[model samples]
Target: MAASVQRLQKCAVSPTGKHTASVIFLHGSGDTGQGLRAWVRDVITPELAFSHIRVIYPTAPARPYTPMRGALSTVWFDRLKISQDCPEHLESLDSMCSTLGAVIEEELKAGVPKHRMIIGGFSMGGAMALHLACRYHPDVAGVYALSSFLNKDSIAFQAVEQRVAAGQSVPELFQCHGTKDDLVLHQWGEETWSVLRKAGMAATFHSIPGLYHQLSRPEMELLRSWILAKLPPDGP
Candidate 1:
């Protein structure tokens, strides 16, 4: 057992002189916020240069990988196995959800409108991003998930159902999964897509051929395009 930890740090880039949109990047397992910052840099920053968008990268708390030996990493929640669920994992997911809610509230306090904020991540971070977008009240502008899995067994489903019954549309979602991903099966992504579609959520699923459990250049490009499309023309 290891001591519990908190793994969220924020960075801001307001180079255009006006606060436009804000992107919060969540990192995957075994990585820190700084490690995943480059992914956003290559595509997001350049595309939004004129729009003056700001980026925030948040780290996940360190935790031992339950199914693997001699491994520890920062994770939004634990994935015990490819198709297994655990109560502890659910609790951790709840904690991350609360943390994200606080982050959104803080962004509002900082003057960023709900529609101007996008939440995205890779792998485990991607899972967390999907969870947050589906469950967050008032919804977010968009959600991007790269090489990640949706928590089919989590409490997010109930939350989303409640929101839908109230006549609220699910937030826009852009998901990218590598067909060759071995860690999180490609089928998981497809199944998740099916569930979202059945629930009447607006979701776009992209299956990248010949890619693995990591993001490639083209995938990053797709993400950039999606983000741009979700942003307001003048700056949001």
Candidate 2:
């Protein structure tokens, strides 16, 4: 384990004695890690055995997001001045990449192999997860992006394309979006899914019709199962 990993004061749940896998989840803008914890407690069922795995709900650093005119927000990256589509602030995207990178690295140093770790998030956090999966942590088991689109102009996306061209492994991706999502239009998610799939990533996308910008029951179940599917058989 990395001796440098301490003071990771976020909402987390771990098996009482031992754990072999890790899941880091990022919350949407303006929402704290506690929000994700609530979802676990209130919505998630025990059948998933998530309690046996290490789950982390990391809160984003408070910063002035550019699209939000540098207003302080708990956001992974800055957005567009108007819509939730492409053309995210490049600088902010880099910062988010770095932040997520550190988290993945910490888990790696803690003896979790790249294939045993999963990174994901909701909304803006989900967007950041997709960026990291394509760019930073290609070896990660999979990525779960809920109602989040890809970051436009991501250097990681370009790099991953090059790697894939060289026949490298691409991270498995699971994405779902609400068709009625106005915050981040479902069309954008669909388009991103197509781009990634065509690029050779083992990707899946689901469109929840008539749903808004929120987590539905089916989506939650899908996320839980997706994580289980990506990892190796559980360890004792």
Candidate 3:
């Protein structure tokens, strides 16, 4: 295991003591797993309330973020900039993907089927989810990204293309972005969804009106519904 993966901090909620399915959500740039601890405890735990589901939030190790002039920050991967025009830093992104892949492998070893696990995140975390799910773990139940965008010519697209050629299953994607988002422009998210569909992935894009870069209750509620839909409880 890489040093970064070894140092990953994770927060989990498994109140029902059952692990029939799992949801691993990633946090945005500079945010740790504990950063989302409160939300998972207060909001997500109650909203989903599935006795068989387990939720895991993993924190990224602190590293030099190129967008911030190399200042250390907790980011899944480094990028030159957060825009469709800027080319993605594939080297760093691939490294982080491998690290995250290790995390997923742990879950699979724990008895969770690949198709019963869902992966998603917010902002940069969402971008990482896309890369991980699309390129590395295409058999996951589904993937969601909030207030996120992908650069043009992303490896994710290429990976999906190869999957299509091989007749392999590709997970569905649920992408939600606020129209008022300033940091990650809404247009960028929209374009990313468009490109994802063009790449032969089943993607749904939800536009939240009058919302900002931060998450909103309404968006999360919708996400909760999507989650339950994708990972319904097992039959008795």
Candidate 4:
């Protein structure tokens, strides 16, 4: 197993010199916060260009991943497999949600309102974001997931159901998946969206034609627009 990063490699960006909103983005399995930060700097930051928006990239702790035959990886949680048909690893998921919840709690302590925060990520990270937005921090402004999916019986769905029954609002969801994605199939993404809708959350799905299981500039641009719409700058 490779050595793990003990500290989070947080890439904080506030373009306008003040932070009125935050976007916490996580990277895929086997990747680090530093890797995601580089991509955000090269792709998302340039397009987002919002001064009040502070983008944070957090790395997951290294752990033995079940899907990878117990090999160590920086994944939010363990999984039997990447397929939606596989049962979730609730114990690992619980721990990670608590870990990420602390991260959001820190933002709250810093005076950033929960409604002004957006949680998102790519691949496994995206799946974790969905779990957070629905199960742990449903009060967040929004959530965006790229090339991700959730099982039909995810804890997130149960949380959404309870929240809706209590007349509580849930964060809106924005999901992007490439139609040509073979790793996390497009059908799985669509099924996840359907489940979310049935669970009483407002969601949108974007299909990238001819694309694969990777990020694209157009996807980031669309995400920029969605983020702006969700938490627009306070004033001129």
Candidate 5:
């Protein structure tokens, strides 16, 4: 684990000065924020073209992951023990959500409106992003979760339901998962999409045939197009 970053304490700003929108992509466990930031360079092309879109890659807090037998890594939470359901560590979940909320608030205070901010991530990161978007932050542009699962019984569900009942437009979503993903089964993502849709969320799930616990180029292409549609460069 790297001792340099404790969390997404810093925002990775785009060189394009006149930014209109912002995105924060969380990396999977074991990956560093700096590494993911560099990797995203190819995904976000034409720097000048995307000048108005600021993208951030946040570093998760370093911690001992349960599944990894206490091995320390940059993780969103500590999975105490697993069963037929999602990770069950309410305290950890709450703390991680607070950390994520702080990041979102920072962006909001920095002049990025809630509607122009998009959040998503991969694996554990994806799970946290989905958790935040669906339960806590509902004013974002859209959520793009990849290879992740959601904790259905979270207390946040009530808030999400209330938001819908109030007729407020919540963040739209595009969830991507690999059919062959063994770590976080594709079914988990599907179930999450189903629950959100049943709750009246504008969300969709895409299942890539042969992808596993990793990202695929095709998946990125889909995400890119979806993002472009959500926040067009010409849009104000």
Candidate 6:
């Protein structure tokens, strides 16, 4: 048997024929962007039917996972062991942030306003989404993190404090996690929310009972509503 090859790709959906707001979907570790397309199209679009928006899903580069049986798959960063936080992880964080920033810039040039852009992802991608939204100085509309862990708590806290000192208003955040999620756990989400709240950031945290590491249909519905709420109406 031959090793499977992976590739990075992008998909866009614009139902009203023109783009008004946009949502960038980042997939979880070991998964391709294509995995989340049907979910978004089938679940999110109908809920926000009135708004004409574009959804972008981008795949990450494939790499070897040393922590998981030397598995070759796509990940925003190399895997970290359970309950261990490493400062060295910041390097991968910076790389993903840079890539995501470039994608946002491209969308802006194509006509999406900074205030109408929503950055979101699942698992590792979710962590990257939240990290970038907090550090990136653009007028990001919102951020959604699903079943993800925050990397480098000290650095993230410091960044929040610095932003507050500099008189910057943090973007709104929606964080959801399964109470039974062993991979990241609910406590991680609570801690992240605590830090955000202490810094006066607009944040909402939800714990889905009995859910695991995956998203549920109702959760997707909630996300759709949350995204639309952040976007302005089609007309003034």
lDDT of 3 by residue, 76-111 (tens): 888887668878888888888888888788888988
Query: Following a full C-alpha superposition, what root-mean-square deviation does model 4 have from the true structure?
Result: 3.7
Q: Mark the regions of model 3 whose C-alpha exceeds 4 Å error after superposition.
A: 1-5, 40-49
Residues 1-236, model 2: lDDT tens digits: 23432333377777554677888888888888887778656755652355456888888777787667878987777766535345667777776677667777778788888888888888887877887777778888888888877644456567678889998997888999998888446876777777778778888998887879887777888888888777645742
Per-residue accuracy of model 6 over 1-236 as CA lDDT, tens digit each? 11222334776665465667778889888777777776555655453343467777888887666578668878877646544365536766676677777778777898888888889898878877877787874368888898876744546567777887899866788889988888456787778777877877788988888888887877887887798789755622
Q: How well does candidate 5 score on lDDT at residue 124?
A: 77
lDDT of model 3 at residue 190?
88
Q: For candidate 1, give the lDDT of residue 136.
A: 65
Which portions of model 5 show Cα errors greater than 4 Å? 1-17, 39-49, 82-87
The candidate 6 region of ten consecutive residues with least summed lDDT is 1-10
**Candidate 4's residue-wise lDDT over 1-236, tens digit each?**
11221345566666676878889989999998778877766765464467788888888988999888999988999989877777899989988887787778778888899999999999899999999889888889999999988887888888998999999999999999998898447888888888888889899999988779888888888899899999888732
Q: Supply candidate 4's per-residue lDDT for 109.
A: 89
**Candidate 2: segments with Cα more than 4 A from true spot:** 1-9, 46-51, 82-86, 151-156
lDDT for position 59 in model 3: 93
State in Å the error of residue 130, model 5. 1.5
Window of ten residues with lowest summed lDDT in model 1: 1-10
TM-score of each: 0.85, 0.86, 0.92, 0.92, 0.85, 0.86
Q: Which digits, one per residue and each the tens of the lDDT, describe model 1 over residues 126-216?
A: 7788788887643678888787766565565566667778898677778899878874468777777767767777889999988988867
Q: What local lDDT score does residue 20 receive in model 6, on the 0 to 100 scale? A: 72
lDDT of each: 0.72, 0.75, 0.84, 0.85, 0.75, 0.74
